[model samples]
Target chain A: MDELTRARQKACAGSRLSFDEALLLYRKASLLELGQWARAAKERHSGKNVYYNINRHINLSNTCTALCPLCAFSAKQGDTRGYILSPEKVAEMISRAMQETPGLTEIHIVSSLCPDTNFSYYTDILHTVRKLLPHVHIQAFTPAEIIYFTKISGLSIKEVLQHLKDAGLSSLPGGGAEILDDSVRQIICPDKASSAEWIETMKTAHSMGIPTNSSILYGHIETTEQRLAHLFKLRAIQDETGGFGAFVSFPFYPQNTKLAELYTIKPLTAWENLKFIALSRLVLDNIDHIKAFWIMLSEEIAQLSLAFGADDLDGTVGEEKIIHAAGAKSGSIMTRKKLNDMIVQAGYIPAERDSLYNIIKQAVPS
Target chain B: MDITLDTIEDKIHSGQRLSKEDGLALYSSNDLARIGQLADSVRKKISGDYVYYNVNLHVNLTNICIGQCKFCAFGCKSSSDKAYELTKQSVLSRIAKAAEDPDMKNLHIVSGLHPDWPYEYYLDIIKTIKANFPLLHLKGFTGVEIMHFVKISGKSIETVLRELIAAGLEAMPGGGAEILDDSIRQILCPNKATSTEWLEVARTAHRLGITTNASMLYGHIETKEQRINHLLTLRALQDETGGLQTFICFPFQPKNTALEDSITRTSVWDDLKTMAISRLMLDNIHNIKAYWVMLTLPVAMLALGFGANDIDGTVGGEKIMHAAGVSSQKALSKNILIDAIREAGRIPAECDCNSKIIRTF
Candidate 1:
């Protein structure tokens, strides 16, 4: 059989696609035809349910040492706009969130690499969150942050992860895996974590019995082949570790970033976004779910993505700053009601999930 | 009969007419990119590589009106502070300043029905614009406004159109047919002309050799059958008269209007799908317009992939949709339009008010 036909048959039979086969299907298959296959793949994994969660995002700081060209949220140490939230401030925010949200499931915390803060600062924030909301899941800190923690404390990756896990780090948020290739990262996110360092960090965490999520930040400088290669890399890791709870795809938003100013860039079109979602679904056969991050892709595209093989809408992110800094407008005010209504309109059942892909609530069809 | 995208694609390939059932099927299809590709194929069949835009200005002479359209946030009571009635000189100055750019070609004037202004005042304004910029094409008014003139002056529709033509009015726009069905119009816009009267004015204007365009205001209180029938109705009229020049679809902006509390604006899916279906259904109409004022420039750029050939003008200044709380820019420059068209991988063609290609960029 030809590459595309072989790829199509493999996908229909719920088998894995190789890098070259996935790239061929991406280029040759009609958008609708591939969408049909991805839909079936998603159904075999998660059925007709589109999962969402209710979580609160607290950005601890924007002050950073390595302000990548692709990031707008990072502020230099000397910049007057730079800030590092104190433990008191973090405590107050969590207390406010606890009182405000009756059924909040997760405390989603992601921050910049502050030069002024040590390992204690990271662990203190986790301890403060665990102290306030004892039972809620704490999905904080990326592999990049974990690697940074080891550097700041002179600890190994295992020691840093163990300290944070004891203090309250439930799982990794799975960012910092931007394209998973050092050559691409050299342009968009230089001076951060290298591809080997990021995978090493995730694997170390998983070996220590910690579950983590995985992601790819596509649409910047990465090529189509690179995106496919990234997927194969993640699938191989999943096959071995089986520690990834979910996989999210974020299309690069280039509004206030230096990359945007350097080259005239338009964000991914709806066709590209849905196609990326479908491609991820077909290739990452071992991964349980493919997420359409509604924060980066707007709620409208997120709704339409349900048909294009996205089984998860991420969450009702109480507030988000990273994407908002890079020119996404869907920060704050995404209540559970709106997410439910949106999923229902897109012809899927709304499923309220925890951070680990466990359904806490399922919205019955009315 | 089973109507699927396959049948629709086959028909589009053969250049056969798409039935109402085919239009419905295309709308209900979940794969938006396929729909867009098929529409672009149909578009390339007729419009070729060139995409058309015009350098024009919109002039609203007054907001004092008798008809109380619930979907209208532009018109106002004569005594309200927001009321405006431009004198003849102001109108002339507006046109003269806009005509400063040599690229300016058409003067677009769709306004409120001033309850007090005589029919002569309307004729005089057109004559004044024509006298000043003798080369500028005067594309003004709609079918509903023509019938309003018929009511106020007690003249036939043909007489009103002929007089406007004599006074330098070159063509009419296709507004006021918010859905060519009175069952919904009676509740949505009871004070305006009925659908029958609007179609009559369109037919009469075409017979008088006045080029006109057509539009349908959708996304509020209209069924799929109604939208399809609106396209079919426009198709039949174009087949008979062959006078209609283009077609545009306005997604109803449901903010700051009576329907704001009850309905929300349609989405990009609906907008692109509707534009494609309009192209598929209205084969007799040569061009489909993606009005940047109503559909934002981004969506309009994508509409090029869905069979939209004309991106309707710079619209140097417009206020009607803004009053209804549309967030699009009040004015777009000609360079921006050219760049957008070129960025969409299509050749940009500068055109006059009526969409005749002048030069390709």
Candidate 2:
């Protein structure tokens, strides 16, 4: 019997394959076959209805200590380009954006791992933003940044999260979990948190009821095995914590860095990106949401991803800065109407959601 | 059952040299498994299943452009109310801000063909950027900007790119070639870089040992054949120069721009089809990108299965498409980006511009 025939039989029986077997299946299976498997998995998990929400970002600072090579949104201390958002600035940006967007849902907070910043600084910023905007959900901090805060404040990860939680940090945005492989970290971002540290941060956060997201960075120098390893790492952690609410896949945009010279960084093709999403949907059975963050992928592609495996179109973001600095021509700030239009265009229902994937309003198109 | 390595090689060769009829046959065949098998075989053969993306940021030095292309909602007149340009100091500052991110490895610089900026100014800008952040890759200047620089510098495209390369220019962003059809160019960007001009710039860049990317801005008034022609143009250029690295397929965003009055907008079906066809059509190019900023993130994830490999990095700040009124989510953090890719089920490894592995966690 052929290898694919046996694999098909195994897949039909609902028997999970080992990591190596899964890789072989990924490589040998046709796109149609892969899609079929992914679709079946999606149907089994989230079903046909995709999800979207309304959210905004509040970056506390662009100053950093670990200067990773692939970053386009950080600044060194004392650089004229750096601007750490004071509590006032953070509150004002959130307040103005919330006023502009009536259905404003979640306020995502992240910042550089600045050596100068203290835990109180972050807690103060979060508290002030919450004080002014009482209704908005505050999903802030990555594992590494939180770890940095904990180390600075002489608190445990759980204590730091609890403190922030008490101070209006309702959730966490998974930002620092770039390619969970430490070997790759040694080359691209040696100064950043280690792979295990990032996972531990997420695990700790998840245990504390702080639902967060997880992510992967593909198309760089890591081997295919490394890519799978990253997924398995996230999967293992998700299995343990159940704290992860969503999974996002981001490609590297290499336009101006030392790594670009060593290699020519081109964006991944739509098929490869979608295949990954579909595969992620199939593999991350424990996770509830698979978000195709429109900031990283185009809207058209994001819409099509609904069929592939993604179930979430991240909320309407207004005026994003990081990806733009990297060479993104796509602007932030998608209207509810436009998101509805795109959702309908992709043959899905336009369901308005809150930060936690709750259907706040469902618009049935005429 | 008898498919050996030799048979696979033959199949790869056949798929590599596939005709339009072959593509249609594959598209129409009920046996999608077979079609994908063939395509996957081709994919594995050429690039060895290694999809490419980069950690880069885009800095549009100036949105004030001389040519008011019909399709361009981003470019504005220098005297217009929406005109804005980054100064040397500001541009350097933006670069510095971006360089601080450990995951950001490439700097993408594409701008309008400003009428009055001296050639020396462009040269100095590249030199200064390289001098400060010597570690970052400078993928500066689009083809249209390059053409403008050539005209202003009184040098050939080769000499111009060479000088820029010597001054820390690493590669070229394949921009300003709306469509390789002169007729389409006349209608959209009449006074912008000509089809031949864009091709020559890329070809010259490639010949000078600098790999450049090629782009097709579809979903406007261009025909299907025009899309094919655009791909064919890039393919022909690749055939001759071998300088082109990847193909980026951008849909014309008709929002708050001059063209909005004439056209309604591009549908999502057509956009996905274009991205899929790009993967099927461009056999030689190593990568195909579904730029999330223009298309949005959801569609980008969908494109992964259709024929794309990359879903771009976290942009620090973007302006051109915003001026044009193309609303996509901007500033994605590394975590957000990774989560999106992982949600798609593909392994997300942070990479540099040249597809170098950063981290695979």
The DockQ scores of all candidates, in the order shown, are 0.23, 0.15
Best-performing candidate as measured by lDDT = 1
lDDT of 1 by residue, A9-61 (tens): 98768787878888888887755556667888888999879898889998888
Docking class of 2: incorrect
Off by over 4 Å in 2: A1-3, A8-15, A261-267, B1-259, B271-361
Error of 1 at B248 (Å): 1.9
lDDT of 2 by residue, A1-366 (tens): 877777665554445656776677667765556655665666566655567878887666778897778777777788888877777777778778867988888888777898777789888987897888787788888887988887789998889888999998888887788788888988777887889888888888777788888988787777778887788888888877788888888877776555666766655756677677867766677777888887777765676566566778887887677766677655677888878777666556777777777789987645
Chain B TM-scores per candidate, in order, are 0.98, 0.90
Q: Which ten residues in a row have the lowest lDDT in candidate 2 chain B?
A: B26-35
Per-model CA lDDT versus the true structure: 0.86, 0.74
